[model samples]
Target: MRFLFIVQGEGRGHMTQAIAFYHLLRSQGHEVCGIIVGKSKRREIPDFFSREIKAPIHLVDSPNFVADKKQKKILLGKTIRKNALMAPTFWKSLKTIHQVVESRNPDVILNFYDLLGGLYNFLFRPNSRFWVIGHQYLIHHPEFIFAKGKPWDKFLFQLNTHLTALGAVQVLALSFLPKNDLINSKFRVVPPLLRKEVRKLEVKTEDFFLAYMVNPGYGEEVLAFAKSNPLVKIKAYWDKKSAKPIEYPLPNLSFHRVNDQTFLQDMAACKGLACTAGFESVCEAMYLSKPVLMIPVAGQYEQACNALDGEASGAGIASNSFDFSLLEKAEKKDTKVSFQFHQWVDSWPNILSELIVSAEQESGVKNPDGEFDSSPVFG
Candidate 1:
């Protein structure tokens, strides 16, 4: 079946997931016709995307999280106002997506939890099928456990997840651990898609604690931690565009801009991994058998759940602040959990194939080879 991807270009996780899934589908005899990525003036599509993804990538304006002056916490009030101001541009971008889908008439519009899928279904009311793929969607599973935090924040986050799934035929929730006894079988739980570059790496233990800060505001905490612990080497990667790599005078801590290949290699060999509790990074850390120390971004409830879940999966500890000291204990715990997660990762391909066939059948479109009316019969 022909598929088109709608990705939220807010972070590396979704973008990498799209690239990995694109290749996976192609390998299974499905064609990815086009990719529409939601982006903003504040951020451009990462360079690796154009070179790595086989399909053409189109960037369209979308709402972005606005950070406060420190650029660390997501200011929810400010974020809403900023996106409200850009409503016109965002609307036009959705219009462009509508035309693309209408012209291509793809059998499935695979959404990487982009907000546009809902808007497009509401505006154009097209016959296309949408499958929302993201770890965030796992929040709605009846048997899924959420992190303990502010009740309001958890509610808002779940509401946002449902909004992203508006008109979606299925929510292919990506997970770090396996929970097959989900109360809502309407949604399928699948393993996180680690970038192929990451999965192929030869794992080892090195001297450093590799770190990534999704919001550069967290950089201050990293610097403070590195200063306090002078002996532990820390190599961190950030998306601080227009900034040169810095080798701190502290002698053991250095910050470099994100380079996917280098990051994966460093993660594979690093003594431990530290980053915001984004689902994909935690999954990669687990896949590499590296211990994790997660600090969820302030005001992002989805990440709070990830931190709780990651720790529950035996990955590591979570901190409200940058406590790199936890790496020592967390690394050993992750070792115990790695085998179970590996089983989940190995199960995705088969489960995903079944999902694709079901989605295509409901789409009322012929399978790619036209031999089956709706079932995806692989070559």
Candidate 2:
């Protein structure tokens, strides 16, 4: 079978998911014909992704949305305005994507939350089956846990769901939340899709904590924490947008630009993680038996929920600020989330493979795997 994937390029998470899925499909004897990446001006596609991926990659102008730094708010107006300005370009990119898909004639199209995929599905209406795969799809599930906040926040959350639901035939939601949270939804709650590197790694807990954050303001706070902790060595990664790598030698601190292998290696070697409460990284850390010190980005609800859930699962501790006391407390706590995670990871591959097969079959494509040939939708 042939597969085409459209990935959102807003962050490394989606790209990592794509890479993992690509390997899984190839391992199952399927060919990935093409990869369409939605590019954001603010982000450059990492060198590792370009060099590591096996299939042909194409860039497209797709809508990119981000949260505001100070308040951790969505900045809906700004997001809509920016994405609206790209409408013409997005449409043109859709034409290019359609042409590529038509030429490739993939048996299935898997989208990693790229708005361009929604646009493509809206325009061409391809006969090939389509599946939307990502952690973001969890937002649409009715049982999805909502952050404690204002009513307007809830409204905005609903709006986000409506926009993301456009043109998706199937939604795969990744969450640590209970199965009840995923019940009665059009989507399926699957285990977080971890990268093969993370899945295969052997974790060792060393002295230093591994920290990474993409947002600038919160990153500064993390740096501040490292500066004060002279006894504890800290290794961090950030996109500082500087031509030269900035090194702040505080006797116990180090920083590097985003490097996949280095980051994974650091995670494996670290005692724990001290970073923003992003789902992908948190999942990776938990899988590696590393406790996390989760600093929820100031106004982002998703990160807030992630922090709460992380704490609830005993995977990590949550803090509104980079409090040294909280960090100490988390460090002193026994890191036992490892035992709970193995079962989750063991079940995920089968869940994802089955979903992909079902989506393909629904679109009239034959499934090569008899084990997953039936259209089974498990909650």
Candidate 3:
């Protein structure tokens, strides 16, 4: 079967998931014909994604959050106003998506939580089997735990989740641990889509701590903390386009541009990790048996939920700030929990293969080898 991917380009998590899924599909003898990624003016498609996906990538104008001057907190009012002003551009993007879908005519359109993908399906009503993949979709699960308070934030988060899954036939909710499938619903709980590189890494403990911050503004907090504790060594990565590849302002503190190989190598050997509460990195750390300090970007409700969820799953402790000291103080994850999480992650191949076959069968689509049957297959 042929597949098309539509990914949200806001952060590293979604793109990483796309890359992992792309490889997974190819391994199963499916072809990824094309990819349409939601893009904003502030960010560029990471080189690693382009190299790994190895498919035609088209970027289109899409809604993105407006961060403060320091790029620390997301300003809700300003974000809504800014995207509202970009209505025309986003409309053009939707048309582009429709054009691609009509031209490619793939058996499946896998949406990685991009708003435009969902919008295009809703308005254009394409023929392909639509499936939504993201951790945010887990919010509707009855047993899911939410962060305390912030009613408005929770509402907006759910609203976005709903919009991204407008016409989805199957919603794959990526989880840290296994859970029962949502009965009589379109939701299925699945493990994280970690890339092959992450799974092959040789884990170890080193002296220096590692950090990954999506909003470069959080670097200020890390820098301040580094200065206060000059004896502690730190290696951090960010997507600051203007910064040099590697900068060492202090003997014990250094910053590097986000490079996939270097980041994974560092992660494998680091003593601990301090990163935003994005699902991908936390899961990576958990799989590597490294403790983490997760700080959700302010005003990103999905990330807030991730922090709570990560804490619950023994990934690490969540914090409102990038305080390495807190990570140092926290207890290490239980060996049993680490073993269980690893076992859960390793089960992705079987779980995902069943899901793909079920989705294709439900849509009455032929396999890549041209095998087709109308009889429904039970999952």
Give the TM-score comparing model 1 with the true structure, all chains together: 0.92
Off by over 4 Å in 3: 365-379
Give per-residue CA lDDT, model 3, range 1-379, as digits (tens).
8899999999899999999999998888889999999986666688999999888999998899898888888888898898999899899999999889899999888999998878887888777878889998888788788876888888878888888887787788999999998774567899999999998999888899999989889999999999999988999999887789999988999999899999999999998999999999999999888899999999888888899999988888999998999878867668898889889888877976887778656666766777653221111
- C-alpha lDDT of all candidate models, in order: 0.79, 0.72, 0.87
Question: TM-score of model 3 relative to the true fold?
Answer: 0.94
Sort by lDDT, best first.
Answer: 3, 1, 2
RMSD of 1: 4.4
Q: Judging by lDDT against the true structure, name the best candidate.
A: 3
221-244 in candidate 1: lDDT tens per residue? Answer: 888888889998999888776557
Residue 371 miss distance in model 1 (angstroms): 22
* Better candidate number, 2 or 3, judged by lDDT: 3
Ordering by TM-score: 3, 1, 2
Q: TM-score, each model?
A: 0.92, 0.86, 0.94
The window of 10 residues in a row where model 3 has the poorest summed lDDT is 370-379
